[model samples]
Target chain A: MTARRLPSGDFDVEQLTPGVRRPIKLRPWLIFAGVVVVAFFGLIFSRVSLDRSGFELDDLEEQIAIEEARRGDLRVEVARLQDPNRINAIAAEIGLVYPTVRIEIEVPGLDVEGIDPEFRWAQLKAVLTAQP
Target chain B: MVLGVAFVVAWAGIGFRIVRVQGFEADKHAERGEQQRVRTEALTAPRGTIYDRDGVELAVSIDAVTVTANPSHMEDPAAAARLLAPLVGVPKSVLKERFTKPDSQFAYIARRLESAQAQEIRDMVEETEMAGVYFTSEPKRIYPAGDLASQVIGFVRDDDMAGLEGLEWKYDEALAGTPGQQIVERDPYGNPIPQGEFVVDPAQPGADIILTIDREISSAAQQILAQAVKDYNALAGTVLVMDILTGEVLAMVNAPTFDPNDRSDANPEAYRNRAVTDVYEPGSTLKVVTLAAALEEGVVTPSSILKVPGTLEVGDKEYTDVGRTKAKKMSVAEIVAKSSNVGTILIQDLLGNEKHYEYLSAFGLGQVASGDLPGEASGRLENVRDWCDTTCGPSTAIGYRVDVTPLQMASVFSAIANDGVLVEPHVVREVISADGTRQRYEPTERPVVSEETARVMRVLLQGVVESGTGSRALVDLYTVGGKTGTTEKFVPGEGYSEEDRIASFIGIAPIDEPRIVVAIVLDSPSGETEDGSDMRFGGVSAAPVFAAIAEAALHRLGVPPNVR
Candidate 1:
């Protein structure tokens, strides 16, 4: 310890102590705490990602199921509309009667053209083009 | 020193146990843990859809639900049974009996409930906090066309979705797809653990089928058959419309039919696809085959003259004409037009027994049509060597001793319509797999007769519809060629009955360029019309049905009318 003089002859003391030397020791508790914090956040991150993916998978599954059900419903509706008796009744209601007059157009080799393999492409083209 | 020794002994014991548990017993404990966390479930695949030629839905499989339960998980079995009985449409007593055994692990509450109905039950269960009830997705068959082609399309088994009849049964292997499996981790409440190991194997859906039937034509055919059955007061009826060129069965309908969707009330007899499954004597329709054979062999021409008689003696039995007219000189064409029994017998004698049998066999008689339909009968044909009856030759010629399905009879006429080619008749045209691969079937063709002979027979048949027995079969804007058949139904162990008659007609349209063949058969049709007029003859009863069906079918098929 050393003492220094202040103004007016009053002594202000200054103490000088010798530096003490100590050995470095490893603290397992601090390491453990750090590891636990990192692990907790990692687990949270993974759980959030997993939950998001799972929800997406569930949504896609629900969508597929809904689509399949809709397709079944549409098919049934289409068939109902195509019913012949219903169409016939509708036609009758609209005053469309069956034709009574007979007409035949005589074209030479007409039957052969329908059966010929070489002419099939032309017929198919005509049919496709005829569709509205 | 003694305390130290005791402590060391205890330490050794502890270390040994740690080694034993960590090394030797690890696999067993790990397996036990996995079993608790892992579950295996079956993935349900959807059944196939069936469509008509024009992409009309005929049969489809819709989403459904099946209710199942684990009895051990049920909090109150008695209460559960009471709650579920009415919802599942089962008897309360039966449900209570099922719940009596506590040891029972699982029970089925209901199967194949509609989606809306199942959803209501599920919501109720959840709201009531029911513990044991569970639902599984299933598929139920729906025939949107109802009884339109019921016998042809058939129905599937409720539990396994297996086909039981008709084309469904025949093509079951091609229709049913492979099932899949999945392994997933679930919690105690059966909810999937999102973070746990989850593996999935997706199910593969079944193939779709496209049929050769035209819905419009088929519905029209069904309408005609039903009306014929009602008008004639017939017990039942069958009709078939075939595309001559492709040998595609455009329409096949049967009266006394049942809807496959509501099979609980369907009659067993109504399940038969009578066109290919039932056999009857074809009567005068067989005469066309006989005439074709005779003409092909040059034994008779269209103008070949024959001395016709009212009755022809065959063995001890007499084959008499229906009209009992005096014997007159008539051409072979007149014989077919008049449907004279004695004239047909004369024509058959020219071909003799062996040639006639061979021709009949060649025309697809006495053979299975090999259609993709279950329970098709190979109509009865006695061998030439088994001709024990002295009247077999003449009787078979006039369609009495032999039996033929309407399908076979139609094919015979279709052969002539198809320019002498006898193509195999089929209903299924294409099969589309789940993977979008398509397989189309080609019709098997066989030369039944020469083209020249077929044309000549077509001309002769045209006479029958023009001014003869089948005049009623003529359409308004189209020419028709056909044969009228009226046969006495044969009784078991007895001869042909006089009261019960089968009136039938098979007609080809647009005679110059044939496109469709319509065949109609009315079983035991009454002898009176709605106007109280006598209408027992095929020319009167069956011909008009054929006319109406063929007319509509031709119009729907887009075949232009041919008239000269």
Candidate 2:
């Protein structure tokens, strides 16, 4: 250290040589504190997402149950609508009656022998349509 | 010094209480809290559907609602009941009595209400600020076809939906699936808590059933049979239509049937499926077995000559033929066409008792004809060894001393129609499981007689329908064959009823290529037809029913008319 005096009578002190410097070291506690903070926030975020997904799943299950119930109701309604007695009553009200006399039309080459009944009916229909 | 000491004592007491609650009694308190938040709930498995052959629903289970109440929670029980009575279709007085029961915590207001109706009640409760009423989901069994095939389809209990009769009772296990369980944390409003503890074991749904019943044919048969029962003033009636090839029952109609949906005022007797459960003296229907045995044994041909008298004495009993007053030499076919008891008895003597028993057993008599139906009776058949030497053989030969259900008799005719192959009759066609696995019914088949013998028998039956006893069973534009049966109903505690008769007719249509066999049985049909024929006779009353049902069923089956 050196001191300089001037005419103003004030003394100024200055360091003539630089002092020895030390290397900075990272603190373990600080790093650990930072990691803990990130992990805590990550855990909280994941839990929130999981909870949201759970709520969505619950809602989806509830909707599925509701749709299934609706389907069952529709099925029951279809069955009730297809009731033969009700259809018969409706037909009767519309003045429909079974014919007292049935006319048998024999189509040439339309032999239904040995054919499946369902196929025979189809074939008969085709032949009848072709004739008309 | 005293104030300081008191403060210290209070602090010590507080510390001790905190330690005891946090450590010593923690498990009990934790469990109590868990009981409030974590709930174990039961998940209901859906019941199976009953569908007809055409995939039409006969019986179904729908989501319904049941209304219940915590009577103790209601502020004004009388007012709540009055408001709910009209909506629930219950009397206000009854609802009030249920709601006002002293210290009652729970009361059932209504069970199995339709969804729309339940929604209306729920809305009303919410709008009126009702506190006690609650609604929960339940399953309800409904028969959409109304009384059609009611006896065969059956019903379930209102509370739990357990099957009470018919196919429902028979396939209860297959129809009812395994229930599931869950452990879930829920909020105060019973909503599942997000991200809370939840574990679920899923329910397995029931198997679906496909029946052989044709809905259209069944409806027609029911209408016709109901009218016939009314027209003839009979006690009850049964009509069963079966496919000869597959042994699938197309339509089974029982008169006096109760609707399965609402059976509140239905007679208990109406729930009985007489075709499979009740037995009657088969009368001349049994004669087919005798004739088949005779033909199979080579003891008689269709043209074999027989001298038949009006009456034959066997032991202490007498057997006589209807509409025959004198002795006549007739062919075996003619005798069968005439339904002669004396002639059939002679043939039975030719066939012998042991051979007769063999044929009866082969025809599935005295055995439960079907395993698919519940409460089916194996019509009584005495073993040949147990047969009395005096009159057992003779009486059995003439269609006496034997009991048979209508289903059994239908099977008898089906065998002849199916080229003598006796296929076991069944109502269920297939069952489909929740996982789409299918189980189809494979009926048991046995050869009862040779094809040639069956053909001959068919011809003889055709003769009966052509010009003999079953002439009234002829259908328009179809060559049909059938047999007539008339028996004096034997009462259990009394002798044969003088006024009651069991009249029956079993027939096959398009006789050349047989397809369907229809059996009609009428109980105690009295009075006469318009032509003055005795209604008590099977040919007069029951045969006409057979004709109508056969014609309708054939048309529905799309069977081309063969008589042209």
Best by lDDT: 2
Q: What are the per-candidate TM-scores when only chain A is compared?
A: 0.51, 0.58
Off by over 4 Å in 2: A1-60, A106-132, B1-15, B71-83, B92-104, B125-132
Candidate 2 on B1-564: residue-level lDDT in tens? 999999999999999998899889999899998999999999878889999999988989988878999998899999999999999999999999999888898899998877777778978999999998987788988888899999999888877778889999889888988899999999866788997889999888888999999999999999999999999889999999999999999999898988888788999999999999999999998899999999999999999998888788888988778878788998999988999889999999999999999999999999999989999999988999999987899889867888999999999999999999999999999999999999999999999999999999999999999988999999999999999999999999997999999999999997989999999999999998788888999999999999999999999999988887
Candidate 2: what lDDT? 0.91
TM-score of 1: 0.83
lDDT of 1 by residue, B93-121 (tens): 88777766769877888887766677678
lDDT of 2 by residue, A39-65 (tens): 999999999999899889988987676
Model 2 earns a TM-score of 0.88
Score candidate 1 by DockQ. Answer: 0.36
- The candidate that wins on TM-score is 2
Question: Model 1 - which docking category?
Answer: acceptable
